[model samples]
Target: MSLRTALIVLTVVSVTADTMILPFYPQFFAQAFDVHSQAHVGYYLAACCISVMLAFPVWAKIARRVHELPLWVITQTLAGLLGIACYFSQSLWQFWLLSQLMLCLKASYLMIYPYVLRLEERDKHLGMVGLFAVLMQLGGILGAVVGGALLEHYSARSLYLWMAASDGLQVLVCGYLMWRLRQGWQAPQSEQSTPTRGWTPHVIRLGLLAMVFYCAAFFIRPFFTPYWQSLNPDSALAAVSISGWLFSLPGWVALLGLWVNQKRPGSDDHAQVLLLAMLYGCVGLWLQASADSALLTIGRIIYAWALFQITVRLELWLFAHSEPQFYGQDFSKLHLMQNVGVILASMTVGHWVSAWGYASTFVVASVGLLLCALCLLWWRQSDSRNAQPSHS
Candidate 1:
């Protein structure tokens, strides 16, 4: 296979492995260890996020020192092994710790983004980035569907085994890519200064906006399966299947967003697009907070569309603004900020849900998105004013 094809395939398999357990997380914890607390689920998810946040920067540093393909092969293999170990976890705590281990090892897959981008012309970055996002969403869709079915028909342990299998496939692919590139591959040169760059005002604002956006979006994630069960108590299998479909439906909309981005390949109105998306997302969150199941389904679809567009635009903005050589480190910093937001949501939403219920959590999440929209609007206005010359 060509290098591009290999990268794309690796992206699909790596994301599939990473997200395979998402739909069944709550169910797995409840079934395996009889741990039913939403707060506990939040804490576990937070732990996973924290592990990835810490591990990403480390992986970026290691990427600078190691050749990309070999490093990816090692990490993918180790992640697969750790995932298998997680399958045998006997307790909730054991599973949580093993999960963290898997995530830490798996974090190296993130380097693929910058690696692939470096291989292409700068103008192609947005299209390539959108393609990467679309492939990731496709992988997520497949993972959610397969994971839900496995959890419902088979055992929770099967999901871990499947995840491990996916990682193993990635290892083989990366190993092949490493061998194929051996002749022409050069290690990335060491930077004269530290990789970390000073945060510009625009970057700082974007980071804060991303933080709020993620926090709002993920507040309900850890408890989504349980919430679905609460709504449709008739059959566990049906609930799992429906939840998987609901999660996967967004990918279709994301594919549409990718098509649109292809037609208009620029960041002329990214701020406006982002603000509009947040508004739509907030409306979706409110609809979800309602008691009607139909409305909830519609809400999920709406939220997914907005999420797909927002993420694609945000990544384009990052690539457009940052230096090419620093893409890996810069993207890692953005990922870290986003995960910190998720961690904040995971830590607080659990208590909020435990107290006031899921609807209240949704309401708070909508409010958070509104605040993000306002921040973006203000930042844009300030930017426009700064761009204009003095009248004198």
Candidate 2:
């Protein structure tokens, strides 16, 4: 199989194994650790956010030096082992440590995207990126639905065991794919390409903008479940299940979007796509602030749409712009910024919810999204001007 196909398949496995237990994390931590307050859950989640935020950049830089294939092989193996350990974790501390290990493995998955990009024979970068996004979203959908049902009937620990099995499958797939690449790997054809260089002011500015974009988009995610529970504590499990299904719609929507792109090629104008997605996201958040159930459902759908579009574009753009050798580090920095958003969002969102209520919290998130959109618009215009025909 081609490297592109292999990467899409691995993305499915990676997302499935990683997201399988996410729906239950807030409740799981609260119940397992005997924590009562949402604020406490926020703090514990911030621990994860911080650890992953710190760890991915280090891992990315290391992968840039050591190569992604070896990193993938080692991390997946360790992750499967950690998954098993997580199943038997008796204390919250044990669970937390095990979770840290898993995040390391999970974060490494992004490296696979760049490796596949480096390996592809064609220049269909944007199309392949869309495919990767579709697979990831679909995998999350499947994992959440299956996982929620399993959580309904089985112990939460059992979910970890199942996830371990999934990771084991991932390791096998990754190993086989890497071996195949090595059999035919040729650097000569792509090597003539000059690497994009510099820690110059411009490069730094672009990287920082990418970081800010992710941070604003993802900061409040950890609190979504807790917020749902606050609305309906008695039906927390049911609410979670429903929310999982709700979230899955975005994946299906993304798959449809990709399919349409395949049928009728369109502009890969990353800037315009991202700007529109962000605008829609603001609308979604405003709708979410409404007390009406119908309005909330509408908001969820809108939120999913915007998120699916923005992430797909961002991932593709990052790979297209980055030098192959530094793909891992660049993507890792992107992931770190995303986590920073989560950490800050967790701390601030809860307090905002308490002070101004959920409606106000949504408003704040919407405003942040708008501000990010405006910044990206300016960046996009600047980039366009910089793209003027260079003297050949």
Candidate 3:
């Protein structure tokens, strides 16, 4: 396969491996070791999130030192082994440790994102960003669906085997890409940058916004299946597979929104659009929290559309301001921040569900989105003022 094709395959497989167990984490914890505390599942997910988040920066740093494909050949191999180890883990703690290690190793796959950006011309980076975001959402949706199926039909432990196989596939793809690199194909390099220009206020602001925005977007995720099932306890339609599909409704809507945005004209004031999206997201969260009927599904569609808008627009702004040479580092920072949001949500929502109720998470999600919008408001005012002329 061509290098770009190989990289795309690797991205899909790696994302699948990373997220396959996410949809049914509650089930996985309850089934595998018979540790049935929902709080514990939250704590476990939080730890895995932290490991994966911290691990990406390390992988990015390593990619700078070692050639990436060889590094993936080593890390993905280890990651695959760890997945198998988790499959055989006998205790809760053992499984937790093994999965954490596996996640850290698998985090290396995220480096391919920046590598893809570097492969393209600077003008294409925004389009590539949109493509990768769609890929990630699709992978996540697929993983969730597969995870639900595995948990419902197969044992929860089967998730590890699938993850292992996916990682192994990534390793093979890495080898092919490495060989292609050796076939006298020189990778395009972005213009070299001075050290001082690495991270800017604009990038930093976007990272911060991404962290908060992601937290808001995903805060409603962990308890969703249970909540949906609870809402339709007696309905024959409330099967695990159906619940998984509704849970991924936001992703599907986001994909559609992405396609529509690409076909539309580009006259939008992105900052203003982002602000409107935040408002819509908050309203969606409110509707989801306030309703138990089909309004919940409507809320999901609205929330997903808003989420996609924030995502694509933020990326467009981020890459618009960043130098090409800093794509890896900057992308790492953004990815790390987004995971921080996920970690925050995962850490809190489980306990909230355990204590307050599932509705509590949606309530908090709305508040989180509102807070993020306020911050963006401040940022917009500050930028507008700074852009204006000043008498010296």
Candidate 4:
């Protein structure tokens, strides 16, 4: 297979395995470990995010010394092994520690986006990014569905086994890609200076906005399993897993549809699409927090769609402005900031949910997203005005 094909496959499998854990999340934390409250799931999720966030910059530094392909090979292998560890976790703390190991592996793997972008034709980059985003969602949806089925027919332990198998397969794919690269394939080098170019104010600002949106959107996710359990005390783990699958569907739809259209558009179009998506994302947040049952599902779907679109557009927007050679480093910074936001929000949301209840927590997150939307809106307007041609 072509390198791009191999990379896409790896991306799909890695993402699918990661998401499979979502449905079993609340159940695993609350029931399996018999945690004291629903919100404790956030602490577990936060632990994982914190490890990944802390490790990203380290991975970025490592990439500077070595190459992307080798880094992924090592990290992906670690991730797969950790999945086996997750299978044997005996308590909440054990699960949390195992997550730390998983994050170590995941930190390097997430940077595959920038790596893949480097391999693609410049003209095809944005659309391919979108396509990749869609594939990610497809993997997530399928993971949830399959995870749900696994929970229905077997124990949660089985889910981890599948994750382990997926990660192991990914290791082989990474090895194949490296072998192909030996045959004259090389990543595009960044033209910008390493220090002054990456982590710029503009990049940081956009990344921060994206991260905030991610945090607000996913703050509640760590608790979803427990929330479902609370809502239906008699519900089987399968029902909870199905809900996770359903929640991921809209995201996949949005990704597949818009990603194909994201050719090399003008900066103005990029900004417009991103801003609109963030706005809709806020609306999605409100809908998720305010609705119930079927309506809640619809809200989640819209939120997923908006979130995925904004995320892809934002990545494209950053790539457009970046010096090509610095792609890996800058992209790593983006990943760092995104995970930091997620980590903080996940930790904080646990406390909030524990104190205020699920509905109220969602309301608070929705409000935060609305504010984020407003900030981005203003940022866009300011950029437009600044770019206007000066009169003599």
Question: Among these predicted structures, which one has the highest lDDT?
Answer: 1
Candidate order, lDDT descending:
1, 3, 4, 2
Local distance difference test scores for all models: 0.79, 0.70, 0.78, 0.71
- TM-score, per-candidate, Cα-based: 0.89, 0.82, 0.90, 0.82
lDDT of 3 at 131: 75
lDDT of 2 at 109: 74
Candidate 2 Cα misplacement greater than 4 A, ranges: 65-67, 178-216, 219-243, 294-296, 380-392
As for candidate 2, its clashing pairs are none
Residues 1-392, candidate 2, lDDT per residue (tens digit)? 76666667778777876777766675666556665677767786678778777777666555534556666778878888898898888887788888787876667777777667776643677677778778877887777777778888887678888888877887788688668767332333343243534353434544555555555555545456555556666764447656655546678778777887688765667778888988998998888777655687788789877877777777666766666765665666666666666777766766766777656766777887788788888887887788876633
In terms of TM-score, how similar is model 3 to the real structure? 0.90
Stretches > 4 Å off in candidate 1: 90-94, 183-186, 190-196, 223-240, 264-267, 390-392
Q: Per-residue lDDT for 159-256 in model 4, tens only?
A: 77888888778878777767766822232244223553546877888788877777776776655545645665664633845656555566666655
Which stretches of model 3 miss by more than 4 angstroms?
183-199, 265-268, 390-392
Cand. 4 Cα-lDDT: 0.71
User: Clashes in each model (backbone N, CA, C under 3 Å)?
Assistant: 0, 0, 0, 3
Worst 10 contiguous positions by lDDT, candidate 2: 183-192
Candidate 4 lDDT trough over 10 residues, lowest sum: 183-192
> Model 1, 1-392: lDDT tens per residue?
89988888888887876677775676778878887876676777788889999999898877666777887777878888888888888876678788898899888888889878878888888788888879888988877766766766788776888888888888788777777766223455653243667666656777888888888878867566567667777765346657756656678887987898789865657788889999999998888888777898899888888888778777778877877778787788888889999999988877787788867877988998899999888888887898786643
